[model samples]
Target chain A: MPPESTSNSRQKTMVIVGILALIVIATAIALYAKNKDEVGTVTENPAQTSTTTESQASGSTVEYKDGTYSATGNYQTPGGTESITVKLTVANNVVTTSDVTTSQTSQEAAEYQAQFKANYSPFVVGKDINDITLSRISGSSLTPRGFNEAVDAIKSQAQA
Target chain B: MPSSPRLRLSQPFSLKFEAIGTSWTIEVYEAYDRLGDLQKSIQQRIAAFDHVYSRFRADSVVAQIAREAGNYRLPDDAAPMFNLYQQLYDLTDGAMTPLIGQALSDAGYDASYSLQPMPIRSVPAWQEVMTYDGATLTAKRPVLLDFGAAGKGYLIDLVAQIMVQADVRHYSIDAGGDIVTVGQTLNVGLEHPDNLNQVIGVAQITQGSICGSAGNRRRWATYHHVIDPHSLTSPKHIKALWVTAPTALVADGLATALYFAPADSLRRYFEFEYAIMHEDYSLVSSPGFPAQFFGADS
Candidate 1:
């Protein structure tokens, strides 16, 4: 073979090998970048962490007193104005009793009052108010929503 | 031959079967032994029960009794219904009266829905019509007796008994919103009163029953169905109420009764152990109520 042709063939082989190496290197880099992004996204967001901390802090404090507590919110079911007036009596760190003096609600809302009296009032009687989530009732939804708003209002008042 | 996936014969056969005028799913590990025979027997038993209980069927035993008695004498076949009526009468202080059947009919519910507007009328005091003579029941006035309250639960109890006799262990019998579970625990979602699709709470129940009572959009305008005997009108005080107990019958009966009873009286009645949701968006539970049934807060 001629010397020029032999030299050209060697150059072509080098170019082909170089291109293969570049392709492998690019694939590895892409895989590494994709995996790094996945891991980063799986980490919890800062906002969620902060909110959780706040909830935990709120859950640990107890405040009880003899006073009237008011709560306002919108009703989900028979949509209308919602408000509750609770006359609270507290002895020690527990709420001794709470009487719902006034409630402005629709007919459907009034029906749930029995359930509230039956299910929720007793739980708040003797515990440190901080340990209870006023809204957690297994069957009653509308009444608990109102009761939770009332509880939040009471808690805010206590903090103030 | 290439080995196929392991044939796990021990695994329970979970199958959905439609019977009792509705659909139900049955799960049983031992169902494999006589599956075909058991299925046939179940279907037959459900059909028989439906034939006896269906108010729509003119030939049903209930309907026949209602026809023959002519609003006065109690039919022999209706003795069980009469017993339930007596219990509800005592529980609700006559608020949950079977005599309201005619009133409900007058309000446009005659076995089917009537879209026409109905005038709100006072429900007659149950004492005006119902009287008992040791074993026989007599109605002085022409009153209707609708078994919408206790019928579903009674049917579930019967079906559960049959299933147990057949050795069908893990199963749940859900009739409309009433449910009874046996052998295995069931995670049931308590639907929101406003939106049926949304679930506000979940209850884990094993070997018990749960019933939900609420005024849906269907009965929106005049809450006349669950009437309080004292007011002779719908108890506008309660929007929705759900109760769980050892039996669906008691839960259902109490739900209807409590929805109409005075708040103080109702509270005293349920002092034993139960959960109640009032209309004002408040929830109350008895000391014996189970918190574990409700899932842990997120």
Candidate 2:
């Protein structure tokens, strides 16, 4: 994410210092892992799926091949089977961009999908929950002041 | 082999409470031991703010202003809140006004939560009804001033300030839907307005704030919370909008302002990233907005 537009030089300096500290901490962890014979852990995930002979010929484990990859995930929902298309661009072992598009077969699912597009917030998607945990949701809150009371009042009135 | 750049994770101490007619969730990193006292302090702070700001309460300063017009002394923090409102009011040509409180009440989003529409009343111009000089607010007539647009976000920032003063550097504060993150990055889901079970996308916020506003939540008799005093009707052009700014106040205020004016009109005055979902469900967003959509790729 880009820095806040209004961030001043002081904030920029702090960010730089923070980055340096993170790098130092990362180096220490890396050294510790190497000492424990765990140097291969970083490349394990990518190496499992990779079919590239270039990395094997070079005698080095490449964390990720810089390329665009796309996949379609099909899931069974109550309405029907739904498919989601996920596209990712990786650069230097880090994901540079990502996109997900949903395809629904049923009309009910289509309606819900239409509703989904009508609402928005800035949110990040990751393959794992551990990778990026959702802090909270930013959208039109479902809760309203005295909503339950109003509902109950209407129910009681109807019953009467 | 390359080491992953991800940081180690730990559980953050969480606090949940309801105030100002909304829910508040605060998560503090490495501050688990401090939360016991911090919770009380936060509650007290919100109570104090409600005493001054809440129009629902009969004893609130806002209620006093509604009852009669006079020179009222406001809390010191009112400067930023009022100043932002003044700026937005001018920028939108009175589309966004503190004076909308009366109109809102007329539409029955009043103190009682009546949700019943009454004859709509046009909001008076700021110059005719009230004037403020940061500290003292001079009201010429009984006018209801509602800070509903950004008060929650302002309160969240105030709570964040308290946490920072207590040496809690890493934290996230979420009130209703507005959120702020500091010293930690968080993935926040963008809830679908019609269906709470679904989300359109997720956004990554680090040391920044994000707020969203939509007319779907509080609708009654073809009206939602965001009522245009001029039209005496709720805006229908946009379905929902979200903004990410350096502070929650800006994000929250702009979320409401976007209902009145386009992002380009407000961009010159505030620095923020925005995504607006039109009534047609076509999404428009800033280039640098840190989010990934569920169905935007097509």
Candidate 3:
């Protein structure tokens, strides 16, 4: 074989090996990052977090601030004092979704709270925060008042 | 297979709201994470049922069936309802008929709630006009399905079935007056049609259903909504009737049937406890019914 031809073949082999090395390195980095990301997610899920436990024990769960807002509220009922926690997702200045959790000492109160959530959330879902007018929601008079308070807190936080 | 998710609700719980244009109270022992979802589902089911059975809506399936002649495919969930309806029809000797819708419209309790009976046509015997062969519902002639007697009660029963499937052991569903109680013994007052807020009797039961029929609330001009299918006029024989049975559907149908059937003839249809208020201001009750009249109370 010609000396120049031999040298060119050797260079081509070296280049192919280098390209394979780069591909392997890139794949390793991607797989490591993905695993790390999965670990982070499992460790940081809000529902399973210490913060969530603390807030739940204290009668509320607050979460999701970027484009979403959460606040804890208190209300008075014939059964005494109870707490309500609301998490709202906002898009285009309108409330998109609402998740409400009520911390009540009585099963009856909790059930009432669930009814309030089902009834009132629809009216608030697509409305702007400034226009929310709470009313007597399916005999759940107190929860609506608490919802108003929670909305007020979210408004103050978002400046919307 | 993945094990079913467990819902760890403690003690007794209740949920109250409105649907199908009436108040409803639901009490249950256990609730789940998806209780709100279940409530929404129930609301959707009721709305869908209303869309099919509502005579008020011009576009409802019943109204459409009345307008468009010939055989039509029944909705999937309609088979059981038709069976129950047929049983009531035969048991009541055609008095508790789905064929009464036209007669009711003629008497003025119409889809428009105009409260005027300008019935375009008279309703004949339901068995003669309609035929149901399990899968298909055919109208031999133009007829309307009122289903007013048992629809609401059947709906309550359907919802109860859903709750039962979700592992709910103790529950009570009170839709306006028609009630279904499970695992709770409740004392129900039988209302007098002529006397407001005055009950002629009271009944108690657990794991059973009760429903009452009266012309007290829905009356217009000189007529009440409860029309006798045969005469096309409200039956004055019994002013009000309440029945208790294994399910709300049967209880409601039996209450309507009592308006037509003689007191003794009812034993052939089903076993239930009932109370009837006669036109002469007399109240009679089954031996098992827990009844104490206002004047009879010592």
Q: Which numbered prediction scores highest in DockQ against the true structure?
A: 2
TM-score of chain A of each: 0.31, 0.33, 0.33
Q: List the residue pairs that clash in candidate 3.
A: B106-B117, B106-B119, B107-B117, B108-B116, B108-B117
lDDT of 3 by residue, A1-160 (tens): 2355664444333322322232223223333434454211111112222221101111221221224444444444456656555444444433355455568876756766665554333221122212322111110001122323443454466695
lDDT of 3 by residue, B1-117 (tens): 111133245544667876654577786645555677667777777888889888877878789878876887777777777888888777778878888888777776666554544
What is model 2's interface RMSD? 14.6
Candidate ranking (DockQ, best to worst): 2, 1, 3
The TM-score of candidate 3 is 0.60
DockQ (0 to 1) for model 2: 0.15
- Candidate DockQ values, in order, are 0.03, 0.15, 0.01
lDDT of 1 by residue, B153-265 (tens): 66667667777787766666666556777665566665545433334445566677777676542242354346554554566555556677777766666667767554346
> Once superposed on the true structure, which residue ranges of model 1 sit more than 4 Å away at CA?
A1-160, B1-32, B35-54, B61-81, B120-142, B217-220, B229-232, B262-272, B291-298
TM-score of each: 0.56, 0.70, 0.60
lDDT values, one for every candidate? 0.49, 0.71, 0.59
lDDT by residue for model 2 (B167-205), tens: 777788999989998877887877655445445678888
